[model samples]
Target: MANIMLTKDQWDALQRHLLPNPFKVEEAAFLFVKVTESGDFECVDSWCMQPHDFDYQSAFHISLRDETKAAVIKRAHDTGTALVEAHSHLGKWPAEFSRSDLCGFDSFVPHVRWRLKGKPYAAIVLTTADYDGFAWIGDATDPVRIDGLVIGDVDRLGPTGLTPLTWGPWEDFDGHI
Candidate 1:
């Protein structure tokens, strides 16, 4: 079996929290992960998408922004963690990065590379129904790989499921680490 880099608790907490949003206004969330020398990954910090200078829908059209981008960078800097960016897709999941996602990456990765001196970064694609993530190494357009999540307790398809992770509170659970 391939080694599990992220812990079960982390997976559970992420599933218990983050959820998809269906509003027309675009929403975003910031995430950071601490990567140990041994290659283990742990959550460091997370922030919900707050309305910034850009008009809400404008962010959706332009992709994520510098303030949010800076939050990701700050978390990585503080914890010596690799950067991980996550957001909700409401109820959709495109097979590949959308034009906006690509745009967001184009603006951020170069900053991350310069700040971390070329360290690896991760991106998480989430929906109210399911979840997946990617590790962007050499190129943002081509992720190293994608992983379907196995969230504990919560059924991906159930009548009374919580909103997708983004709609929930931003939490830091030690158990999740």
Candidate 2:
């Protein structure tokens, strides 16, 4: 997977925007982060969706309004940037895309890519403690898995600290299949 670099500020901004109620598990949260062109690999702006803006919501599910989705696409188009659509997993459990999350991605991700001039698009499931991410780098049937995440200041590990013999269940799980 392509590496995504976030400055200390960008990482902090997303953390705050995504988890308004970090301890609440009643509904999933969602946001879209626009980042620089893949080659530059930097985060730029983020748009957080409020709970009341969703059409569907629950501890394990979420659906944004059609308008919100359109807005995200427009922002990417206007800025010539890639977009990372991230959501919450609600607790201490490791975060990975769920079955329904994958299903929903299959339906909309391709379209979002097409509108963004084929720029890379990513999905992230974030929890209070950690997150797992996946990206569609170039139209593959499945996404390229993000092996590790590095956020400046917030999460810092040397190269060896990042790589390992095996990733946990989230890395091994693919509910879509």
Candidate 3:
């Protein structure tokens, strides 16, 4: 497996997305960090606004919907990219994956492996405020802590002025400026 990872800068960008403006109630923009067979990590595509609704006629929840699932499968199949589904949590609670998160994994893992020819995949969960996150790979039944990752700021948009700027993967608090 490659040493796949996400930078703090990226996380800051994601936090801005969790806000419930005209978009959150209906959808979520899916982002990811894909590790290639060549052992390099890159932030690939972004699903501008993935619908949060799913089957069962329940209230639209915050999560990767079926359409988002299809998109993930296609990306994995076409590029041989391992999965890394990242999304924002919109509250002050220290970021953690909710039940919906597990549901997402249960629904996606098999399809990812089968569709991508058994490539390893991971899920990245972050807070709306960029306070905490974790990575889940291989065993959707298990979760791993991301050591050395911290959030210095949140809600500031990136160069495009639409995405926030998140920073992480720091050795210590090396004076983040």
User: For candidate 2, lDDT tens digit of each residue in 1-177?
Assistant: 555567777667777766665445423323344444543245666776777668776676678889878877887787777887777767666565666676677669889888877777776677777777777776574676654446774564212121121233445655333
Model 3: per-residue Cα lDDT over 117-176, one tens digit each: 665555444444443333444544344443323233332221111122222334453321
Candidates ranked by lDDT: 2, 1, 3
Q: Judged by lDDT, which candidate is best?
A: 2
CA deviation > 4 Å runs, candidate 3: 1-13, 19-27, 32-41, 52-60, 63-65, 131-143, 146-177
* Candidate with maximal TM-score: 2
Q: Give the count of colliding residue pairs in each prediction.
A: 8, 0, 12
Q: lDDT tens digits, residues 1-177, model 1?
A: 001143456554554444523344434555566555644334555655655623344423434455666666766777776766666554354423344564455557677867876667766655555545555554433444433332334422211112121221224322111
Superposed on all Cα atoms, the candidates' RMSDs to the truth, in angstroms, are 11.1, 5.7, 11.5
Q: Quote each prediction's TM-score.
A: 0.60, 0.75, 0.56
Candidate 1 global CA lDDT score: 0.50
Clashing pairs in 2: none
Output the better candidate (1/3) by TM-score: 1
Query: Which is the winner by lDDT between candidate 2 and candidate 3?
Result: 2
Q: Give the TM-score of candidate 3.
A: 0.56
